[model samples]
Target: MTETVQRPTLEAVAARAGVSRATVSRVVNGGDGVREPLVERVRRAVEELGYVPNQAARSLVTKRHDAIAVVVAEPETRVFADPFFALQLRGISKELTAHDNQLVLLLTEGRDDHARVGRYLAGGHVDGALVFSLHLDDPLPGLIQRAGVPTVFGGRPGWSDGTSGVVYVDSDNRGGAREAVRHLVGLGRTRIAHITGALDQTSAVDRLDGFRDVMADVDPRLIAEGDFTPAGGERAMRELLDRCPGLDAVFAANDLTAAGALRVLREHGRRVPEDVAVVGFDDMLPVAEQTDPPLTTVRQDIEEMGRLMARLLLRGLDRLHPDEGHDPAVGAPASVVTPTTLVRRASA
Candidate 1:
């Protein structure tokens, strides 16, 4: 049998770098409290010796797993069908990979899965969590709280009690929706309508608030509820046209919904922008650009939001390990609202 090649140990790295084993360990962990010059020396020695620290042993000493859990609470079909989650996952994965942390994905389909997720998080399998797609009355938030794991939400959570201390990242849904409505109004469209997403979601709720902000006296008959799906959008659009044939503008809560509405509008002989100006949120590439006349929509940096969520969670983890030199002030923000911009295209 061939001889097994021995791996370089911490002692070997220390000898190569001309530092004590403890110093090497400290540098390997995070280099907190170690001078810059020593850090470089240790890094160079690690490279030269191909010294890879034993993560299991290191965790035993530092009590950190260097792993993050990403919990996506949505239907499995929706997760696969929508590009939004894929883009966000790309951003989260990139940031976590850069920090040498493992990503543990937890997909929750329903109530039963929520309990399993709670148990896993409480089991101490990860250092922190990034949760997404939370609906109103979601039990995961309370479960996460009970687990005592540091977590950052992907969107504004809808909890009856105040989310005073809860940390989250979300787009300016209200502002974006307002802009979309105001743009339609600028085009002199008086009979404007709003297609709302599932009211149970905070993003959807915020968008509706923005619509109401712009159209304070909007006709109650002009509002239709959709489930943020193409099918829902199609049904809502049909219902709106039957109720208000004179409507000239519509602001869909999301791009997929907008695309569905566009299809129905075409079938009903409505010329986009000429007969009915349409605007959508999310600016999802697949639906927005592929629509017959393209689409004018609100653009939220979905990927950046995902990246920020990961970064915030990592920072929170660092703060917990004060010895790692992380600033406590990093955890001061209770929520971060990313800005949104309108992208003009043929649809509007």
Candidate 2:
């Protein structure tokens, strides 16, 4: 014989608390406009009865799924390969979990996937979204905006024209790039070169701009295009060395890129920080610290950026539904640009 345990219900809680069903409902929903004493009474009753409010029934009353969709415009391979995405997701997951909200990940691989994601967002499956990995020509942002869901972007989006009220969290990419370049200059590396990440990404574009900010009127031959990957870095480094064999330093857009460049440098019989001083952005510990001679790079709080994005999105949601346990004290959500630091290592 099998036995099924019955779950405690709102009616049982109301009966135990000596309150009406309506009172219990009010308290259970959000406790908004409910007196503290009564709320405490209901809560105590709930605890005593082990009453678990049915999320499905609650959603019907509150019209909120209490779930958030995290849309990443990258394939599974790229998402899994990069530690940056994992750290960001961890931050987002922690924040959302603390708020009793569910996270639904939506990954896109191609144009067809984008359409499918757009449709899902339009279907009202979740309360809001946290979107990441946007490219300059990416149409996902536009689709999300059209879907009218509250969203917080993980990085600065590359819209052709600045759209008002677009919320995002990003590191100071340009500033970080400038610091890396200036550090190389301080080392008296006159023939400095740059290996850029994919130009399609705003982060890469901003970093490249930062390099030029310091190296104004730099030789065009010293710049090599990279894809923010070790393989891309390897290819770009070879191109830079071939084009300007006399270059004394290299500023790669990211740590992975720098690692690749370092490998190529060693292959060419150039000693790092001696023959060619190297600098990289994104002090990703696994890549930066593990590199030969380690790596001097710009450090951005990737996990913190993720947490901020979720916080901003949730705050925005609260603003929209002020009566639903929304705290008035929390300020309006705005775009945030977290600062970056240049972490010094032996490589530079």
27, model 1: CA deviation in Å?
5.3
Clashing residue pairs, backbone N/CA/C < 3 A, model 2: none
lDDT for model 2: 0.90
What TM-score would you give candidate 1 relative to the actual structure?
Answer: 0.87
Candidate 2 structure quality by residue, lDDT tens digits, 216-294: 9999999999988899999999999999999999999998899999999999999998999999998989889999989
Cα-based TM-score, every candidate: 0.87, 0.90
Instruction: Write model 1 residue lDDT over 1-348, tens digit each, in one string.
Output: 999789999999999999999999899878999999999999999999999988887788678899999999885475568788888888899889878789999988888998899999999888999998658878888899789998998998887344566889899999999999999999999999999998989999999999999999999999999988899899999999999999999999999899999999999999998999999999989889999889999999989998889888887676333454555455454578899999999988
TM-score of 2: 0.90
Error of 1 at 158 (Å): 1.0
Worst 10 residues of 1 by lDDT: 319-328
Model 2, runs deviating above 4 Å: 1-6, 29-41, 319-332
Error of 1 at 118 (Å): 1.4
Which consecutive 10 residues in model 2 have the weakest lDDT in total? 319-328
